[model samples]
Target: MLISVQALRALAAWVVVCHHFMQIFFDFHATGPIGQFFTDKGAVGVDIFFVISGLVIYLSTQNKDMPAGRFMVNRIIRIVPAYWLYTAAMGLLILVAQPLMPHAAIDWTHFILSLLFIPSENPGGYGMYPTLNVGWTLNYEMLFYLLFSLVFLFEQRHRPLIVAAALFAVSEVLTRLGVISHFYRNDIVYEFLLGIAIGVFHRRGWIANGLWLPLLAIVGGLLTIYHLAPSDRLLHWGLPSAVIVLACVSLEPYFQGNRLLKVLGDCSYSVYLLHVLVLYGGWLAATRYGLNPYAVFAVCVPLIALGGWCSYQWIEKGLYLRLKDWLDKRRNDGELKALSRQEY
Candidate 1:
């Protein structure tokens, strides 16, 4: 993995954590520069995430012929365990604290849909956000995984076209139906496609490896953030994400991983999943103590990072290892049974 890409993962997760903290805990309009900057540009972090997903997912399969079932198992193992744990926890919290958190009403339909990673019009009518707000992005990630798995079923040369077309078709149908909100549309799906394009180009040796790569990445990322707004996240944020990803891949040969940044990157998924719980807890504490919102925001930023690291260590890592071990054992058992049958 590219060190730069890992650094970006940590950076993007923090950007989103701060953005949500500022907007949800502190009023965006009144919180001064911190609010203004993060509120305006924070969502680009998700774009960065999507692009990274594309690059990493595509690159991982290079020169390999993985079974589609096995490919999906690995993806599910990586994503579902941590997500389901947090989702069930959030649902339990909402159940117990319904009166205290009026803004978060639980709908059984929405809850089930969220657990399934299916995009739907939220039965609660509070936008397309699920029981846990961050799960919306997971819907896209799962969709991309499903689409990208085509390489296992078809020739790799034909996969880019197949996946791209499938993405376009799905988004067009959903957008045309008007049943779901635009947030659930395929517009954002293009970001994953952008990442796929980056991977394809990189593998083809089309992207130049040079000193200029880093410079372009920095400038493009800055300009993207400077122009970012509440709308058009796909274009405004996605394009720059591609640029940065391209730069990162191009300069990968020159970069070495920083221990701290690599650790944060390893924990980025946990950070993204668990930060909201930390933010909510901190907000409750702040309100009880009558602390100013900005002070709460200042405190929550570091607290969220701490919470993420802890979750990574205790929840994500443990679950992943246990699941992986069980899977390896299962595979060994299946192989043993086949050999025994042959011997008989």
Candidate 2:
């Protein structure tokens, strides 16, 4: 059996949490090469997430017999509830905090667009809207999810890899031509396609011989660490990360029945969602108490992880399971009623 992708997702989230903590606490402006390097590399965590998201979603759909509508419904059900909750919470936080920050004027249009999970077409900005820096990735994810759903709707699973590749090529071309900015265009489809290809290859037994897997993983890791410029790192590093993850998952033995990793994976979502809050909270407490940046990490990292695990157990997991079951039962009952009518 395939290992749960949740483990990988959680890992990616932790990577991101570390990245953000580095930014919040470390004095990037005055620090040496080491600090600069980490600050630059931290964003690569999102690329890992994109690649993993593609792979896992593709795998989930690849073998299912469900209709496309049901698949889309399930995906939306899984993501939107927690996302909307976070978005609302963040919005309120922003409103409360804006008085002190006195930063950019709030662009209501872009803010609304973000809430709807649409990528902002506006120019003159590098990061996300002032309040929600972490949200930019969600736009790409929502876009990929919609596109993937459409692909499923057409019953074209066999050709999704090809379509994904084509989309990547188009995105690259558009970026070069200045029709789309680099920040706006990405290799989401390509990374996802790579994952799908890996899944297909694994299902065919090609990966059973692990001779080349480690070599590929090493190469990918090197490219991830070195080849990509800071801005283009996602595209450059994401491919390798996807390959490494695919190879790792294919091994199966390493992950099978690993209780600790599985628990971490289960709590990953909560970790991802709540880590930023923890970091910011820590920053406030540390500054108030005159704690050093490094000292703050020493205290906050484990605390945040534990808090995330608790939130996962008490909040995310419970809410997800209950909501998922309710949605599934509702759908099943509707189907049953329809079938009965057809029998009559």
Candidate 3:
């Protein structure tokens, strides 16, 4: 893995954490440069995340053939366990203390839908969000994975990135025109396609190593995402996210061997999953004691990081290895049985 990519992953997750923290800041009227900045640009972390997902997926199967089933299985392993844990945690929180979590709700049907990654109305009346609101992004991710897997079924003549791009273009048009109600008409999906394009270009050596290119790309991406007004998400956030990703990939060499950043990246998923819970719980407690929201916000970020690290170390890591080993053993046992049957 590119250390730069890992660092970006870490940074992106924390940026999202900050974005959510800004919500806390706002409720307490703690408007400032930092809070306002996050209010404007913090949500772009999701854009960054979407772009990174596309880039990483492209690189995963670059110049290689991976079985679609295996690829999907790995994704499910990587995502589902932690996701389900947090979703259930949120649902449980809502159930046990309904008054404390006014922003949350629980419904048996929606809970099941959330577990299945289906886009259903949040019982909390928060649009198409799942019990764990972050899981909504995973819904998009699972869709992308399912679409990308189709490349494995077709012949090598169809490049996966091109296929993804075409699918997004067609789906967007159809969904927007109401010709396809099944697909959500969202501009954000283009962000993934942009990432795929970047990966394809990077592999083809099309992104030059010129210092000015990367610097300008990163700076321009930030400006467009943060400052551009009256623009669609695809234009402001998605395009800028793609440019930033390209810039980050270009500067990968400088970040190599950075252990702390890499560790943060490794725990990024857990941090992303668990931060809201920490924020909510901490804020609730802080309010009870009349603690300052800004101070609580500051404390919650590190606490979330610590909790994420622990979850990554024990549950996420342990579950992945156990599940992978069991699957491997089963496959091996099946192969051995087939060999014995052939001999017999």
TM of each candidate vs. truth:
0.91, 0.82, 0.92
Tens-digit lDDT string for candidate 1 (99-196) = 76777778788889889887666655667777778889998899889877877778888877888887776678755787444654656778888888
**Clashing pairs in model 2?**
none
**Model 2, range 1-344, lDDT digits (tens) per residue?**
25545566666787788778777666345366656656766666676677677667766676556565766676666666666666566566556655543432346686677667766643225554323557777766665666666565455445565447546755677668877446546544466666666766766777764546765775667566665665545456766677666766655665678787778877766666667666766776687788887787788779877987777765667776887899879988998999999999
Best by TM-score: 3
Q: What's the residue-level lDDT of 93 in candidate 3?
A: 76
| TM-score for candidate 3 | 0.92
Score candidate 3 by lDDT: 0.82
- What digit string (tens of lDDT, one per residue) describes model 3 on residues 1-344? 77777888889999988888767546524357777787777888888889888888888787767788888897898789999999999888779878866777888999999999888888888698999888888988887887787777666646664566656755676667766434356777777888888888888888766567788989998888778752588887888888888898888777778999889988999999999888878778786798887688779878998999999988788899999889889989999999999999
Candidates ranked by lDDT, best first?
3, 1, 2
Sliding window of 10 residues with minimal summed lDDT for model 1: 178-187
Q: Top model by lDDT, which number?
A: 3
Backbone clash numbers for all candidates listed:
0, 0, 0
TM-score of candidate 2 relative to the true fold: 0.82
Clashing pairs in 3: none
Off by over 4 Å in 2: 1-8, 30-34, 99-111, 121-126, 129-131, 154-157, 162-184, 209-216
State the displacement of the C-alpha of residue 332, model 2, in Å, after optimal TM-score superposition: 2.9
